[model samples]
Target: MAVGARLTPDVLELDPAAATDRIVAELRTIVGKTLRRRGAVLGISGGIDSSVTCALCARAFGPERVLGVLAPETDSETETLRLSHVVVSTFGVPYVVENITPILAAARCYERRDETVRELVPAFTSGWKLKVVLPDVVGNDLYRVLFLVVESPDGRQERHRLTAEQSLAIVAATNFKQRTRKMIEYYHADRLNYAVAGTPNRLEYDQGFFVKNGDGAADVKPIAHLYKTQVYRLAEYLGVPEEIRVRPPTTDTYSLPQSQEEFFFSLPYQKLDLCLYAHNHGLRAEAVADAVELSVADVERVFRDIEQKRRTTRSLHMSSRLVEPVAEIDLSDA
Candidate 1:
C-alpha cells in the first residue's frame, strides 16, 4: 500500500456539526466523570486541532483549570511558539514551555554519534559513496534518518537520505518532547486532580498521524471526532487567534517548515479531506468529483489511496497483536 492510504476516504459524507457535538458531549462527560477538579491539561501545538481541543477543554472545565503545555523541540519555529502562546492567552489558561533539546542530545550520545550513517553501509556497495557527516558532540544520538532513497536520472545514480535528527529533528526530538510533556502533565494533573486532555482530531486519528505511545497517549480527548475543517470552524466560534486559524497546519519538525498535508498528501488539507470523505463512504469517484467540484482523475486517485489505506491499517492492526487468540472458540452450548 502507498504511504498515505489511511488518510483517504472510502465515503465522503460525515456530518461535521453532528460529529463535533457528539464529541463535545463526550468530552463533557469525561470531565465530569473522570476529572475531580475544574481544569484540564493539554499539549498545545498552536495548530488548529490542538487549539480547538484546548478551547473546548477550557469551555467544559473552565479556563483556570485548563493548563496548556507547549513542548517545543530545539528546531521548532518561532511562529509555532507564538501561536501556542496566543491560544493559551486567548483562553486565559496557564501555560508552560518546555524545551527537550537536552534529552534528545542525551539520547543521541547513548546511541553513538554516527549510528544511522554507519547503518547505511550495508545498503551501499563497497565503492565511493556519499554520507552525511555529523558533529562529533552530537554523534548519532542527535540525528535519525527518516528515509533513504536511491534515485537515478539518465543513468547517473545518487543516494539521498533524509534524517529525522537534523532535517526533521522535530519529529524524533518532539516525540520525546511530547512524551515528556505527557509525563509532566500527568504529574500536574494528579496534583491538581484534573484530566490530561488529548488534542488529536479525527483526521489525524484516521491517518494514524501520531506517535503510538507519545502524543496518542491521553487521559481524555476533547476534540477527537472533529475533522480538520470542523476544527477550524470551532476555533472561530471559540475565538482562537486569527493567525492560527488561518495558517496552514505544520508539525514543525524540520527546518523547512513543513505542514502535515504537504508532507503526507502533497495536497492541501482541505482538498485532501474532501476527497477522502467522498471516497471512504463508497461514493462513486465521478459523483465525488461532482460534489467537491474536483477533477474526475483526482477523485479516482483518492479512491485508490483509500483502498490502500484500509488494507494497510488492517495489516498494522494485525501485526501489533501480542498474543494469538484461540483460532476457533466454541460458542455453541454456552
Candidate 2:
C-alpha cells in the first residue's frame, strides 16, 4: 500500500497467477525438501478450500504423486461424493474413495449425537435430521448461543436452545467424524510415504473453525494464509472445476444442509473477509462500514466476536507442555 491509498475490498486482492506459482514452489520445498516425503495426500471435500489444495498439490508434485482421498460418511450431502470426484478428475489425480461410515458407526458417533439431540427434542429419532446453528451476530445484539434444529420423519421441524452439557456432548460426538477422516488420511499417507495436506483457509485457520487433531491435523497447509475470497481467486487460476467454484460454502457435517455462516461465522464469507481484513489492519469499524455494507456497530460486534473466538481457541494451537526444553535434531537438507 502507498501513502494515502484507499482501503477497500481491493486490498484483499492478489495476482492469482503469481500466488499459484509461489504456493506451488513453496509446497515443493516444504513437502519434498523439508519433509522428505515422496508426495502429498489430502482429503477432498468438494469445497473450494480442498479443491484448490488438490490443484496446488498436483502442480507441486505431479498428478501421479498427488493422491486425493474421498472420505464420505452417512450424513454427508449426496453432492459431496459427486463434487469430490469432479475435483480429483479435474486435476487428473489418482484417488481412492474411503467410506468412513462404518468407522463412525462402530464408534457410536451417531448414537451418541442422537441421544443428545433426543434430550432436547424427544421426537428426534431414527428418521430425524439434525443440525446446530448460531444466532446472527451482526444482525442481532443478543448473546452468541447455539440452537438445535431437528426435522421429524414427516418434515415437521423444531428448534430449541441447547443446554451447556448437551452442546458439549453433541459436539464431542460429532468430532469423531473429523478425527476419523484424519485417521484414514494418515493411513494412506503412511502406506505411500506421502505428506498429508490440510485445506483450511485464513478464516478457518485464524478463527479456530477446525476440530483439533482432526481436520486441523496436517503435514503442510498451502492455503492457511489465503482468505476465503482470495482462495476463490486462486481456484480460478488453478482451473478448479466451475461447479466447485460456484458452490456455496458448507459445513457438510450435519444431516440437513448448513452454511458455514449459520454454523459458525457471523456473516457471509465475502463480508466477513472484508471485516477480518479491516480488523487485522487496525482500521476503525467506521472506516470499513460502507465497504462491507454493514453499520459501524455491526462491524464492532464482529470485531469483538473475532477476538472472543481467538481467546477461546488459543489452546487449540498449542503443543504438548514439557517440564523443560529439549533440543531436537534437524534432518532436512540444508
By TM-score, the best candidate is: 2
**CA-lDDT, candidates in order:** 0.63, 0.92
What TM-score would candidate 1 get against the native?
0.71
| Regions of candidate 2 where Cα sits further than 4 Å from its true position | 1-6, 328-334
- State the lDDT of candidate 1 residue by residue for 1-334, as single tens digits: 2332333332334555665566667777767664445567888888888888887777666788788888776557888888898889888889877776677667663134234434553443323222222232111224223343322233334444665554344344346655666777777778888778887876766666666556777777666665676677677777888888788777676433456754454456666677666555555656555545556776676566555556644432232453766647643432
RMSD of 2: 1.8
Best-matching candidate per lDDT = 2
TM-score of predicted structure 2: 0.96
Q: Write the per-residue lDDT of candidate 2 for residues 1-334, one digit (tens) a residue.
A: 4443445888889999899999999999988888899999999999999999999999999999999999999999999999999999899999999999999999999999999898888777778998999999976777777999999889888999998899889999999999999999999999999999999999999999999999999999999999999999999988987889999999999998999999999699999998889889878888788888888899999999999999989988886777866668333334
lDDT computed for candidate 2: 0.92
Query: Residue 179, candidate 1: how far off, in angstroms?
Result: 2.9
